[model samples]
Target: MVAVSQNKSIDGRLVAIGCNYEPWIALLEQSGWKTHCCYDLRTADSILEEYSPCICVVDLSNNDFSLNSISLRANKTKQVKWIAIIKKEQLKTDAIRQFINNFCVDYFTVPIPGSHLLDTIGHQLGMLDIEASSWVEITSQHDMGLFGESKSIKQLRDMVRRVAMTEVNVFLTGENGTGKELIAKSIHNLSKRKNAPFVLVNCSSLARDDEKLSLLDGTYRNEEGAPFDGTLMLDNVEELSKELQDNLLAYLQAPSCESLDEEMASDVRIVATSSADLDAAVANGDFSKELYYRLNVFHIKVPTLRERGSDIFLLAETFLTKFAREYSTMASTFSEDSKQLLLRYSWPGNVRELINQVKRAALLAEGNEVKAEHFDLPSKANLKQSLRNIKDEAEKDVLVAVLETHRGQVASAAKDLGVSRATMYRLLNKHNIVPDVRHYNNGYARE
Candidate 1:
């Protein structure tokens, strides 16, 4: 294997341990990287202390490469760019896959292409260069509105990518304010018909059955007189009037309408979103079963914010970064206590609610860090917090946590909170968190 020197001298050095050096070394040397290699990691600690590698290549597939030892090393030197090489079958385990994602820059499975490996390594190195140059400047801009890196979110992203590759109709199902419209727009942005119209019409907003049908029919013929052939997002599909539903069924079943030309008929992609459980609604006679089945052809269920608990922090941090800039606030993070409170609370409104709260806290924060008091959680109600009222502050925290747990169900929250129902009612009135009588069921607020 030939050895090539890097253009910029790597001060921290590069280390490869227990890797199949014959193949990767040839590629690395060809790519002009001179790395220090070692088969034994027993003296890795001393070697790391001496060399302090900026990059570490650990081939976990090798029997000699101890996963436990590598994990320890990774924890000690978290800054290093660790690249793991393994067999494809090893990735089948969720734990191993997650561990790699959490710790490594990337992974290369068996049957590796030498050129692809070089390209990936080069790309990762380039990213490091970019990151070190001006991290704040590089990361500050925020137009990519999607958030979350949880396993569920990763799966959702993969699903979105797959759906975006096609021209088929997509049915997005989730609770209200779960960003169903955002998902639709994402699909449109990624599709071949991106340049065309991305129309959105809330089925619930239509005044009458005719109005619902006319909404699509009107859009079919654009203002420029060109047939609108893009993405059509029918929001709140469950709320579509019965006649409108029948018309939609007819369109999906037979896109070749006599009034439509060849180009207009084939170009449009339909995406429908519903906050309500349409399948359950259909079974309960609240929605048409035929329409429900038609829409369910390609379905995606967006998880609620609470369901993705770990993602809350990422979303909160993202919101804070934006709000800090917009509000000209110096608050860069939530206080430790505030962070615990945020994680403990259940987000009924999903991502939308998190954004609202983060923006509010950022604006209201008196210092560089957002404090628990800045949350203004509904349970705080009207309880006046005087400088001497430590008990009130503690009570407010406890009460707010309980209310959020019950989704604003005062009596249930009070019961969990270990207070009498009467006291809970009084507290709710004082805090302005009175449970909505219309939607209360199973000790939780439906909305």
Candidate 2:
């Protein structure tokens, strides 16, 4: 066991735990991160409770790095973010991996560059400040599902709650992947008819007008043989056919009609979502005006990720935590660079794309921290180049590497790359690269 030492005070109140704190302390102090050193695990609780440091740097390289010790410290100082210093090889051990995963926020492998380590510490401190200052009071019960602290999100939550009280048809407008379906679900779950069926139909997926008319007119029943009574969500309603739109309008005009039966006449709340503007569609003569007016009774415009301000960070952290638990990985947070990339990204696909990227990153990440490259996002630096040069270079490198590995066999290389032989040949020609087939017994040669 490593010997224990009394806590030494530093200016910044950041805590460092380990016997090897001398080198790290000097480096951190030089970088303006004045840290108090605590060599004993027993004194860690008191030191943290007294200093209440937002960040703690722990040395996992010490011989005394045991699961019980780490878990004790983590349990005691639940508020502080722990950064682990470990060797790359140490991660191969399952017990060590589990301990780090359970406790650390981020980690630096041994022989870490001074600049990178400092940047990470600074980022953790900054994130802590952001979290402390931006505590938003979520007003509605369904606000947790909406997941945002921004004014726009709070206003939207209020509107959703107010609208959910009545049985009025609700129209939701937002760009694709802006959680329209989630908002619709929230409304259905919070509404008076929540105990009944909440049916969802993607209008764009219906191939024929007859199918659309049958479903919306309450003629088509789900496999469960139950009628839609709670809520009927027509997703991408702007894609409804002209005939379908007329049928919907007619149904809205007269709830009980000659063709409509008593079961179909039951009050089923309609919640429709559209990425396009129904007003513009009406002006363009694509959508029926009467139908548009009927569905536009109570409209809720879901805000995009960009407009949600600090919500991006909150959502990213939420997704990371969720996927980490799901994938059984230790990645608890993003690196400083990854966080910057997430904030700067335009998120053309919005929350859906963010979830996908985070899930994929968590499953594929090798270490405790998720890095920028794990997201597979295009480099903003090279996006302005129209992707022509970068695309060619990347393609050329792949072709050369595959060809060499397969010993100049085009068919095998093409198969491995998931490209057809013809397309591969065209790519080779475009790059002016010729494959050598001299070793072929069939005597097939390419010059």
lDDT of each: 0.69, 0.73
- For model 2, residues 36-81, the per-residue Cα lDDT tens digits are 4445766776777776546777777755656677768775563466
Top TM-score model? 1
Of the candidates shown, which would achieve the greatest lDDT relative to the real structure?
2
Question: 265 in model 1: Cα distance from truth in Å?
Answer: 3.8
TM-score of 1: 0.54
Give all TM-scores, in the order shown: 0.54, 0.52
lDDT of 2 at 183: 86
Itemize residue pairs with steric clashes in candidate 1.
381-431
Residue 4 of model 1 has an lDDT of 20
